[model samples]
Target: MTQITAAMVKELRERTGQGMMDCKKALNAAGGDIEKAIDDMRAAGSIKAAKKAGNIAAEGAIAVKVADDNKAAVIVEVNSQTDFLALQDDFKGFVSDSLEKAFAAGYTDAAPLIADQESAREALVAKCGENVNIRRLARVEGDVIGAYLHGHRIGVVVTLKGGTVELARDIAMHVAASNPQFLAPSEVSEEAVAKEKEIFMALNAEKIAGKPENIVENMVKGRINKFLSEASLVEQPFVKDPEIKVGDLAKKAGAEVISFVRFEVGEGIERAEVDFASEVAAQLEASKK
Candidate 1:
């Protein structure tokens, strides 16, 4: 019998980029032999799966699933390298399965859900012949939940203490369109306000150079308020009815917006630009050699 050590597992994980438990199990199965563990892991496709980790998977769909009771909803973004793969039925199925599993298990974060679907994810990657990644996940559970998915590209979930499904869905749709950064004006951070103010002041420095200090202060204050109105969900006008603020609409409906989250596929990822003809030519040239 071989005694497996944490140090051995760490080394194997570092070399292979596989999960800690998977490396540990491999190490234990190989009698604490790191090389044999590596071989066995590769034979099991774990190494091949891990190798796909470096590929850029920035294009995919946003999947939103609500619990049967409608009290909870989960949104997940699963990424692939190209839209072609993203639109595939198999890829869509994986995203749906991942969201369902997360919703059923009440997962609020991506880490646990990713771990839970590790084998399935690996299998999907192999089947797709491309890197498939569960990029982000968010779940909201509340007294009432409203979810809206826009063309499978953007998803919004809203939670309220007291609200009709219509109100909730309306708020979610507004969130999808407005893309507010804060739930309310009060939720806007002082640091963010200061940063925006600084930029505004710098840009208008010459215009305000000779103005009275009080007047300049008022100008800055007005600009900041305008910025807050645009960035705060409650302060923004409702998308359906532009005359009323979202806060007023919520209040009229006897509901308070608890929290909301919006997800857009590949929001922050920088995708690589590859020249396909050149890539094919290079592959052909390499084959001749």
Candidate 2:
């Protein structure tokens, strides 16, 4: 039997982009022969899977898992290269399994959970012939937690200090729909307000020009106030009951919103634009050669 050293594992990981444990296992199986380990990993589709890592996986699902006792909930976003693959049972199953593991471990950061699921993710990538990624995870915990999923594309988790699960769920649903940026006016940062003010002034520069200074200041303040009301979750009108605000609704329920996490599929990923017809033509041209 040959011994595998840390340097061997590190070399394998660097060469293949595989997890440390996987590299160690492969090295051990290959009798400490780095070349043999590489060959075996390539044959097992691990290398092929890693090669697909560069593909942008901006399409996928958001999964939410709430604890049995309703004290905590986890929301995760997993991505695939295309929506077609994302909708497949295999990819959905991976997302579900990943969310369960994160929730079970009470993982606030996605790194460890992602590491734990590396093998499964690589397998899915190899099988599906696309890039798959466990993009992010968010955990919310409080006296009461409520979670809502909107057609697997959007998920929201809400934490409340003193509220019924039903109320919390309602708020979560609202969040999934409204996608507010801040929990309240207090949570809105001064920088954000300043940015908004700058944009508002620039857009209305002509109208505010030559106006009285106090009047202009009043106009800017009013616009900033409106911006805050729109951007803050508590100030938004309840989706179910347009007559009432979310803050008022929570206050009526004797519940205070602690925090909320809302995730929408593919929110921030920059995807490559492919010309399908040209791609097909190129493929056909290559085939002729």
Candidate 3:
């Protein structure tokens, strides 16, 4: 039997980026065969890493970069189970690398960027020991794309055509604050418009009791249009100057807001429900053991 020397283990550990004890065990198992041991560690470590995929990542960071000409930009969100993990070098480094890849990925399509069919997001579950998701991504290729990240909690990306940097950034700030889902009133779906009308009719129909069918229909349309405007970014009042509408401001400035994307961490994730009484009883039972 070949004696596994410390030097062989050290070299294998350096190459594999794995733990010291794990390297030592693999070396012992492989009879001091450095290459075989490194391969063994990689396989085992990756399996161990896979077990962490189920962990919920409700915390993480959003990042964005604008090209020099402002002709394009990339935005991404990398979520971790805890803020501490989000701040880790490995996690943060992966996010930046992902963003860089996105910029060069030919187009800004989110599906292709995050797709495990091509992306390694699923495989990464093992290496990071935490669920990491590209929660939301945005890319714009025309004229300008500007962005703002409000702390780690929220991110905004605005696409602009024929606008100055200040205008573009100010719009990004607006998106961060308002959190509208659609870029323009037209982008609001018919279903969403109908739903708003239904809610308004339910709430106010009593007050307008016995109103004519035409009058009721007109009232519903009025309410639905207002709802669409509120839910759409272009129709919303500009954050800097409430007197001017966002869309109108763009037109006045010789530009248009092509679209925007906003991501608020944990916004779409359903939080786990905790049964407090049951949890307390379980804890008590465990303590008595």
| Best-fitting candidate, scored by TM-score | 2
Per-residue lDDT tens digits for candidate 3, residues 1-289, read: 7887787767766655677887788888998877566446557653222323235778888888888888778777777788887778777777887888887775466677776322366545545556677776777667777778898778877888888777888899999998887888878787887788778878996877999999988888888778878888889999989999899988899999988878787787776776899989999998997
**Which stretch of 10 consecutive residues in model 3 shows the poorest summed lDDT?**
46-55
* Candidate with more favorable, higher lDDT: 1 or 3: 1
Computed on alpha carbons, the lDDT of every model, listed in order, comes to 0.88, 0.89, 0.76
Write candidate 1's Cα lDDT for 121-168 as tens digits.
877875676778898999888988999999878999999889788899
* Model 2: residues with Cα > 4 Å off, grouped in runs: 1-41, 44-48, 277-289
What ranking of all candidate models by TM-score puts the best one first? 2, 1, 3
Q: Put down candidate 2 lDDT per residue, 1-289, tens digits, no spaces.
A: 9889898888788767899999999999999987678768979877854445346888999998888899988899998888899889999899989988898888997999989999898788767878889999988888999989999799999999898999999999999999999999999888999999999999999999999999999999999999999999999999999999999999999988889999999998888888999999999998997
Clashing pairs in 3: 49-126, 50-126
The window of 10 residues in a row where model 2 has the poorest summed lDDT is: 46-55
TM-score, predicted candidate 1 vs. hidden true structure: 0.79
TM-score of each model, in listed order: 0.79, 0.82, 0.75
Q: By TM-score, is 2 or 3 better?
A: 2
Q: What local lDDT score does residue 154 receive in model 3, on the 0 to 100 scale?
A: 80
